[model samples]
Target: MVAQDFIVDLNKPLVFQVGHLGEAYQEWVHQPIVSKEGPRFFESDFWEFLTRTVWWAVPLIWLPVVCWCISMSIRMGHSLPQISLMVVSGIFIWTLLEYTLHRFLFHIETKSYWGNTIHYLLHGCHHKHPMDGLRLVFPPTATAVLCLPFWNLVQLMSTPSITPALFGGGLLGYVIYDVTHYYLHHGQPSSEVPRNLKKYHLNHHFRIQNQGFGITSSLWDKVFGTLPQSKAAKKSR
Candidate 1:
């Protein structure tokens, strides 16, 4: 397909219109940057799609792969419900992975030489430019780099079939978690739950950097007992 120009009407939720297809897309709409809450930069449709479409599409890419896996698993003797369970299990596995990476890796305070360098390379850059498009999520190269080792490790004790099903599900979940984390930072939440999570995440960025460690959920913080306790203290005064 040829490249297309599109405009986003921020007033409408989650829709894009193609203006014209050309060598590249262009933006032809803009809205006033004013709101009851504060100033808002009404995003162009092209920009919104650029930000959102891939994240929306990622889990989709896994669906066919997962469906194939599920079908194969059933043919290989697993029940249909077990295949269904694999999908659900994949999501929960993603939660734990997301939590562990956020708490330990992203939040690791590096006082030494290489530690700080690696820390910044991995996440500090994102903290600095939370809005940078190219850096929104760890690129596929980075994902592959991190995923390969664990993928190999899982192979040591488990069947080859288990690896893809498990890893595909976990990777799908990671995509969701990573994109959700990005949205929590950059996109406006539609409901109270995400709004609250957004607030919790903002606190991680601005207020208490050490608290609100869980991005997908506060489950780990509650589980490990490291969740921030001082936000209320500051607010109650």
Candidate 2:
């Protein structure tokens, strides 16, 4: 199927239109379109609304949870220094998690109807509509659900005393990631770091989809050897 000059028919359900692409869906979905108008998912207004989220919504919904987790750690007798370390550790773990999830799960390839549909809703939509500001961050509901497994994994890895702070740290890391991601798409960075990040992320959307999965920083990408061979990287080296 021809990708250029293709436009999504916003009138009909987007799911069906995407499905109609069949094997061509993967190719079509990655062709970036700049639009703030989000595509419709469900017929119901409620479900469709849930798919779009603003950048600030991440901190608004999750900051309290992060604070609560940190408070719980304090109550459980963890020292301030220990808690600080754990919180930072959680954020560190989150950075790795960010890279891992983006590379493995979000970028997963599948050909089945449901697989494509689920993938589209999860991450493919962002690729197709990279500048849709509303879809830049993960919705709170979905993040809440995904938190369960990660929480359990943290518990399994460490004891309960440190879990609160550690988990809170990771959640904060996710928050930082979401905010950074939204900023990469919409914010103008006055400094060099964010400016570089914006260009790096845009390359992922517009140039190479399989490489450069790191968002908050490109540390993981370099370590994993998934770094984009963009001229910027070459020149920097």
Candidate 3:
């Protein structure tokens, strides 16, 4: 028999109660916001293992990817510094994607008809059904669809050879971001790791909307001046 491990049933509906606020938003004001999945503590499952593997494996894989970049550079008669520059450039591209996805996609308000429809299709549904688990990451289908246009844009600026390493690095960054995001909501991060993420994200749900845009790293938000100063921020100030 399969071992039955930790089990939790919150029984609460998996969404924020609609219509509680004075203003009624056709898409959000009445729909549930959070998820109803029971909180399971430290229970290892296939999905959990997959997430952990990706979290641990991406950095390891980067070595070979870098090697491939080196091989390509040698074949193309480019210098080592040029190859390193490509990797750094890839990282920078990821930063922009991270900021854009967070600011525009995750934060899109579905108040308007088209906006509401697309918002739910993109992210509102996740807020409404946060515990669905399957929907947490950008799905493979959507990723392909979105990457094509962006790939075209990048091609305009550089040669076709750079796409693989550039896309690989950005995708690696995305894998890190998605896994970290899931863990933040469901995993127990150590106190030493920094609890600001918990508070920052919570505030996004409960308090204001203009703060804590960083998921994997807050560098973009810090650079762009969007990070809100929390009480901790205030004390430091």
Candidate 4:
């Protein structure tokens, strides 16, 4: 049975209703709705604004940090080629990280009250209202919060000189992912690659949710056997 339009009471907390749907939650959340308006996460307008992110805000906020980190690596004695290699590696690593997060965290299967609420706030809202332009990109505030431990991890895993450049590359990959994600939802593609990507991503949103977890690149999907059940998969065999 197709899910009918759900009328969330703006006066009440959205989490209590949609978040407590239990078994009905998965199917309800997956059924995409076409609307520019997104549900309110909080009653406070000030806090609510933090939940919505403009796509341009990503690059505007992070690009300078990326450039700074890379430039810092150069000052720390890493050559351009070495820094470039680390940066590329970081971007490549980001692709795998992207796949892992999308599949494991964002799409986590849960039935607990808090779990469901968190899931809905983090990603289900996006799935439910796919066309809400404001929520397409993650809020910079949330991203900044996430960056702390990630930066520490990068520092520990790599040499000091490489860490800055590598982390910057990973950040760049994230920026590209967010922007590409927004464009895939809102932009018209005139080229083959983007056109296919748009199709691939839409398949994830409108078709099967278990597959095609990669956004900027489908490399992990092909490797992990989660590629969508479409002609592309058939041809790959």
2 or 3, which is superior by TM-score? 2
Off by over 4 Å in 1: 1-75, 111-113, 156-159, 233-237
Worst 10 residues of 1 by lDDT: 23-32
Q: Model 3, residue 102: what's the lDDT?
A: 76
Ranking by TM-score: 2, 4, 1, 3
RMSD of 4: 3.4
Preferred candidate (lDDT higher): 1 or 3: 1
lDDT values for all models? 0.57, 0.88, 0.56, 0.87
lDDT-based ranking, best first?
2, 4, 1, 3
Scored against the true structure, residue 110 in model 2 reaches a CA lDDT of: 63
lDDT tens digits by residue: candidate 1, 1-237: 333423334344311222221222111111112222211222475533333224445455545655665565566676657666665666677787777777788766554435544554566545544554444565544565777775675466357656556655666677778777768866898899999888887767666666677887888888888677665676998
What is candidate 2's lDDT per residue for 1-237, written digit by digit as tens? 543334558776686456555566788788877887766777878888888788899999999999999999999998899999999999999999999999999998866667778889989999988888888999999999999999999999889888989999999999999999999998999999889999999999988899999999999999999998978678999
**RMSD of candidate 3 to true structure, Å:** 9.3
lDDT, candidate 4, at 204: 95
166 in model 2: Cα distance from truth in Å? 0.5
Deviation in angstroms for 73 in model 3? 6.1
lDDT of 3 by residue, 201-227 (tens): 656545655466777777888888887
Residue 128's C-alpha lDDT in candidate 3?
Answer: 54
What number of clashing residue pairs does each candidate have, in the order they appear?
1, 0, 7, 0
